[model samples]
Target: MTDPLSALEAAVQALPDDRTLRVRYAELLADAGRHGEAIEQASVVLREAPEDEAAKAVVRRAALAAAEPPGSTPAAAPPDDRHEDIDWSELEASIANPTEPPFVERVVAEHDEELVAEAGETAEDADPVAELRRETVRLADVGGLEVVKRRIDESFLQPMAHPEIAAAFGKKLRGGLLLYGPPGCGKTFLARAIAGELGAHFISVTLSDVLDRFIGESEKNIHRVFRTAREHAPAVLFFDEMDAIGAKRSGNTFSSFRNVVNQILVEMDGVDSQNDGVYVLAATNHPWEVDAALKRPGRFDRMVLVRPPDDDAREAILRVHLRRRPIEGIDLGDLVRRTKGFSGADLEHLVTTAAEKAMTESIRTGSVRPMRMDDMRAALKEVKPSIGPWVQTARNVAEYSNGSGEYDDMVEWLREEKQL
Candidate 1:
């Protein structure tokens, strides 16, 4: 049998000094899983054009392909090695240094639906060679937000599980969801839970992961994320703090951001794209800032309001936080009533504060003491629901700025809570 690769190799040798030809050859080798040869070809290009960002990318990608064992998504999404190709030093001074808030403040190991105070490594530290499947965080683990969980089951999970039935009713298997609510309200956790429900891989995209200081790279980064999800089919690609990346493009001085938004729109539902098993989920504290075009029909089409957990959820959140702790005779009912309107994070903080009180008492008595109702009340006096301020802002938006009634869910919830 004639060897096509050998012919290509001969072509590379014939024009060994042609960087463009060698680059094409490298790409073909990498795609064919001939990553070792691909790496060698890319190295040759880098030797000639050391500053070539494209060549550097070939090297990074080829090395990544070579490291993969057989067929499995790599544990950590590779860094934007394309960033290595461009020199951002000159542009750093001109680019206004917008302060980026932390993506994930901390991690805790799951202990029977409870977020035990156990610390763990981030995604970057996960095993690259190991199978990518890890335990999915189901809705049960979520500290409350029963309404949000039901919506996900009805709107998202149902569609995912019964694709044929959905298609018969004119629903496409692929789509995007935008979960918007106040900070620390378990939006990110809900997205993970949704992924878990479907038994799909979840990729949480961040502004830092997509936006680049160099030109055009932001768009490429977005493409790379989606491509990764498609390769690992039946996957959920989530974007946290999405408003920052998908902001309204109008009147934006930076065309680069506009370009990134445009890229996202195209990727979500391009005519030539096949996103069948790739579900898109995005979380944002500020959905109002997201581009109107993104919410039109195909991209981020449906928006879900993730309000603070109700009393039941508060108790659940409290139980999860106080489970392993030394807590005795704590009245959950009274605490839930007092902690009304608190988000899940607020509830966790409430428990933590109460524990701190117990520790202080122990420090004086030289003996550990179980948390008590008094400690809970003392913490409640100091720490109020953080959702109140955010809810106030949301109220105005829901009542006044809801031109299309998209914020109806949030508005209804507000009215029911008497906060409207």
Candidate 2:
């Protein structure tokens, strides 16, 4: 047989710059265990057409093929109706290109309607957590929420790192975790960081994403969310502000929301531990608003509270927010003490407003200078905590404590500051 490297070189030389031909050549090279050459060819194609869907599809296929055990055959092609592995841009081009061949044209015609409709719906109702997860930033990028971070590492990250240990004990590795706290307390940031830690594809679903005007479409969308997660196993499925769809059904409430919640419960319960390598993580400010059924043992079994920052956390948050800026005579420790009730988000806004004020002063005086202590102090006076209402609501839900005994430090701080 001819060497795969020689075959690839000949193919590339014959159809240089042709994205499709290059992709096919790369795949064949990968199958023949010439990974370096295949990667180089794929890289060249990607550089030329950064948004080339066909090229990306080829790269994914080739990488999977190259990773297979020696003598093992490549996996079968995914079903035609499945959009999970479809090259979205290639599908679009096929639909738009008038001169495409008959078979290609027929496939496009058959799938385009459903695909386009689904895409349109998804675009219209994009989940905020899903959007956040796409960025996939390291844990260091997020400021504050250290306690929550440790809990996440202990719960999700540790299990992911040692899946065999978890599996050997007959524990279910796939399930959901609930992060409940005030908004902007870094719940979404932790979710993204978890995805980064696990190296998993993250898909965010929301109440708006699944809810629809059509009678049965809402349930169908819920099914699609889990189905997509299963297709992309070892994936993180995040639901932000879960209260919207996860609210417990009350006697006087509308039946539509109830049905949607029921559908979600059923789908979540049906996820098999072995087959579906999915991790569902949800964030909500109002844990009280979540349906009782959803919070039960089998569904979102683990609930981690991401509360407002403590003194040390606040100081850390301040330092991170001020890292890029030029500041003078600012005592972060004192600032942390003063901002007793401030959330991580509140501190960020405080820093931003302070910088703006300093810039305005500099422009007025015609002198470019770093922010002064007065600028930050003035901003602190104006930027009040946004979590007061949520705090009271949380206190009203169940009790002021879950008896974890870890929040004594925060409680003591609140007492010292006379904010409890």
Candidate 3:
């Protein structure tokens, strides 16, 4: 029998410099246990035809071959490593056997669900909603909202569990709670965490999914949101960025949007006093933009403020994001202090950008190690904080915060910092 490596070598020697031939040659080399040569040849092909799917396919195949156990047999390698030659057999087998999807796929899938639910699909159709609802926000992931979480658990979650006891006195179970804060401050994430703690379905709705080009479509979408909630009773309906559809209607604007806002007001009001076991959770960066009628007593009675992370919260954010990364002798407390006024999202980005910078530097210097403090400091120079603009808008809105009025703290913080 002919040796596979010898056959592969002969094949590579026979091939021309054409992109397709090079790709095939690389695949055969990889399958024949010559990964180093395969990688080198694939790299050349990729540099020449960066956008060639066939070339990229060969690179991926070469990578997997290099990763395989030393003694494991290589699978059949395609001549032209294109999508046409994708090992459907392997993919289908994995899907049937059920291994975890790649990390990128998982993240992309989660984001896709988020985008869909935000457009206002029923909770039942949005499977990711259920998954998000199951994600409990550990005190660590929440950053610096200790006081807020304590109040919420004590005031809302605990009370709702024992509604009969509350009713025996004078208190009744509330239908909804609204969380308003600056963008990227973790409002959506907090709502998901709440749903997780409650062991309920998290249905996230947004204006994009509900609003329609056709007349009367918006109202119908609104009905569908509520109707689905009723069907999946005892679920949490989380409306993110509610201002888009729930905005206060100016007398000068088109009546169509005004009517939709009015319909939301009516539905929210209708849900009150009804113990159908459905809980309404809403969040917005622009609370002042919401309709006055919707903020009335019966609609969204309990409003919570989800402000940017304070110093302590920033530390927590840094820790959470850096958990899986390689770090040595890094002072988290110092980072937090230096990153005052940063949001949870900002901290995550800071860590990621720093790691990327370090990786690039390592590649250049032939170093295979985690990023150091100097690399992080360099990234900080490039990644500015996003909270400044948010704090200003929050202050302006706080001045007019009539209902619940919980955003006063955020406003005060901004004022003290002279950022408002």
Best by lDDT: 1
lDDT of 1 by residue, 1-420 (tens): 867677778898898888888888877777776665675676566544545665555555655544467687643324665445544433322222212211112233344123222325333222212123533688888766778888878877887799789888987678789999988888888888888988898887887687643334567678778877887888888888988888888744444567778888888888767798889999998888898999888788888988888878888888889999987898888888887778888888888898999999899999998999999889889888787677888888987899998888988888898888
Candidates ranked by TM-score: 1, 3, 2
* Consecutive 10-residue window with the lowest summed lDDT within model 2: 97-106
Per-prediction TM-score:
0.68, 0.63, 0.63
Residue pairs with colliding backbones in model 1 are none
Candidate 3: tens digits of C-alpha lDDT, residues 228-340: 66666577778878787677776313334666786677676654424356778889887777777777776776777776777777877788788898877778777877787
The list of candidate 3 runs beyond 4 A from truth reads 1-141, 170-174, 271-275, 398-407, 415-420
- TM accuracy, model 3: 0.63
- For each candidate, the alpha-carbon lDDT, in order, equals 0.74, 0.69, 0.67
Q: Which 10 consecutive positions of candidate 3 have the poorest summed lDDT?
A: 97-106
* Model 2 CA deviation exceeding 4 Å by range: 1-111, 114-144, 271-275, 398-420
lDDT ranking from best to worst? 1, 2, 3
Please give, for residues 1-420, the per-residue lDDT of candidate 2 as tens digits.
Answer: 997667767877987967788887876766666654565576567545545655555545554555468789777535446647656545433322122112111123434456557667533232212232343686666666666678778876787668799889877667678887778778877887787777777887766676643334456667677767776777888888898768777731333456668778888885443325788889988766788788777678777877787777788888988999989999887898889888888999999999999999889999989987899889988999999887665544434544654334345434554656
Relative to the true structure, candidate 3 has a C-alpha RMSD (angstroms) of: 18.0
